[model samples]
Target: MKILITGANGQLGQEVSRLIPDASRPGRNEMDMADPGAVGRTLDEIQPDLIFNCAAMTDVDGCEKDRNSAYMINSVSPSVIAQYCIKTGARVVHFSTDYVFDGTRGMYTEEDAPDPVNYYGLSKILGDFAVIPLSNSLIIRTSGVFGEKMNFPLFVYTSLRDGKEINAIESSYSPVNAANLARASVEVERKGLSGILNIAGDRISRYEMALGIARFFGMDESLVRKGNKIPGGIARRPFDSSLDISRATKLLDWDFHSLESNISRLDVH
Candidate 1:
């Protein structure tokens, strides 16, 4: 397939790229999704038969600080990509988040209605809507993705390595392995699955995930402290954004790893 991966340098994007080594990978400077003109020109050039749109403005508080940029990248850009794919008969794999839910509950299924609590989630929810009707498209909602690219778990590992204390949030989530999610995405695409599907690791809290990272790396788990609130945070987090992957589990006949197994699988720098 003539494949294109947006945000190819990001955490999930890099993992996706590693799995699909020959896919076209444009840097942010090359195809900034925030700019419609750039996205248009890039799409025209690539004319990909498949698109893995891993790009997004993911910083929750940053999304709250700049709604325009958030909506542009998270919503408008995906709309543009979907429109392009619609005309060209290309299939797309759109990455989404568990943040679409309000977190009043846990293990949310695809049937669950999204009631986002923050601007970032709101923007991503809008993005999901834009791609919902696109034929042959797959929207995979994942959570707390960490990989070779710097992410939450890496932060904990480094903090403990430096002998600095870390405040691990108490929010519960399925901290997905980006490598696992990426590999599974390819299988899901090959299986011709459409619409929304959940792909994530076993559910656990930030504190628990922090300790798992420490255990994997043989670091001091005691350095990780638990807290419910982010100090001076801009956006409100969901209490439990863990996704229920029952559908994906049956479809792929593959379930993600447990926290311990997942961390063990990672090189986890």
Candidate 2:
């Protein structure tokens, strides 16, 4: 099958690229998601039967500072891609986040309403809505995705391994392995699952997650400190953006991973 994976350099994108080695993996220069026209042209050229839209301006604080760029890349261009998928009868899997919820309560189901607390979440919500109308498109809402790139787990692992101190926040989230998330996405897409699905690992606090990383990496867990809030951040982070993956769990036949299991499977060099 002709496949296309955008945001090839990102954490989830990197994992997806590794799984689908022969897929067309494009960097921003090849198809800048911020530019809808460019994305449309590139999609036309590739004519992919399956597309993984993993591209997004994910930095919550950064998205707050630059709302225009966030909306353009996160939602507007995705709308264009969805339109193309509808026209070409292609399948698409767009990744969303747990931040779409206000975080007032935890264990959010797919049927829950989205009350985004920040611009980043609002932007992703728009992207999710854009793809919802497409019959062949699927939206996967995940949380705290981590990989070898610049992510929460990697940061914790490096800091502890280097004997550097870490003041992790107490915010709760469901940390998912990007590799495993990619695999799960493929499974659901193959199963003809459409609409929204939550695919994430066990829910845990950021500080506890840091300690787990230290233990998994054989580092001093004492080096990690618990912090209350992000230092001087523009965006307001949801205290608990944990998603309920019950649907995905059943669809995946209880193959969902937990924090400890995902850490055990880490293949860092």
Candidate 3:
């Protein structure tokens, strides 16, 4: 099947590209989702059977600074793309976030109501809402995703290599790893499963993840200090964003790897 992958350079996009044998990767130059006309033109030209849309304005802080850009990329663009997919009879695999939940509950289910606390989360939730009603779309909500092209893993690697102290949140929590999330998305598309699924890793806090990585590198875990969220920050993250993947297990019939396994699989540079 002819497949189209948006955000071909992103963490999840790259992984999804690798997962597909020969995906049609559309870079920003070819089809910038931020540009409405460009998205339509690309959809018309490619006419792909499956479209894996991994592009987004993911910088939570940056999104706060540019809410218009975030909304355009996260919600408006995807909704427009979904409308095009509906016309083209293309199945869509849309990447989303666990931030859709407000975090009052520790483990979220697929049926949970979305109450995003920030502009970034709110935009993603809008995209999720837009896609669910049309076309064969699979919405995968994940959190703290780390990968070769990710910022989080790079921060961890740089801090250790530079011998600088690192700080992580002991209170906040979620599962993470871009490659694992991408793999799950590929499997969902390959299986033609359509619904909301949580592509999360073994749940743990940022502090625990740091300690685990430090341990992996034989570094001093003490260098990784636990920190709390800044008071009155623009984004209000859920203290615990762990998602229950029982539905994913039942529907996808594939077991997700543990956080330790995810770290072990990383290149770590």
Write down the lDDT that model 3 would get: 0.79
RMSD per candidate (Å) reads: 1.7, 1.6, 2.0
Residue 230, model 2: Cα distance from true site in angstroms: 3.0
Candidate 2, pairs of clashing residues? none
| Model 3: residue 9 alpha-carbon error in angstroms | 0.4
- After superposition, the stretches of candidate 3 with alpha carbons farther than 4 Å from their true spots are 230-234, 251-255
What is the alpha-carbon lDDT for the whole of candidate 1? 0.88
> Model 3 clash pairs?
none
Model 2 agreement with the true structure over 6-95: per-residue lDDT tens digits: 997888898889888999998899899889999999999999999999999999999999999999999999998899998999989999
Model 1's TM-score against the true structure: 0.93
Rank list by lDDT: 2, 1, 3
- Cα error, residue 269 of model 1, in Å, equals 3.5
Estimated TM-score for each candidate: 0.93, 0.94, 0.92
lDDT, residue 205, model 3: 73
Question: Going through the candidates in order, what is the number of backbone clashes in each?
Answer: 0, 0, 0
lDDT of all the models against the reference? 0.88, 0.88, 0.79
Error of 3 at 260 (Å): 1.0
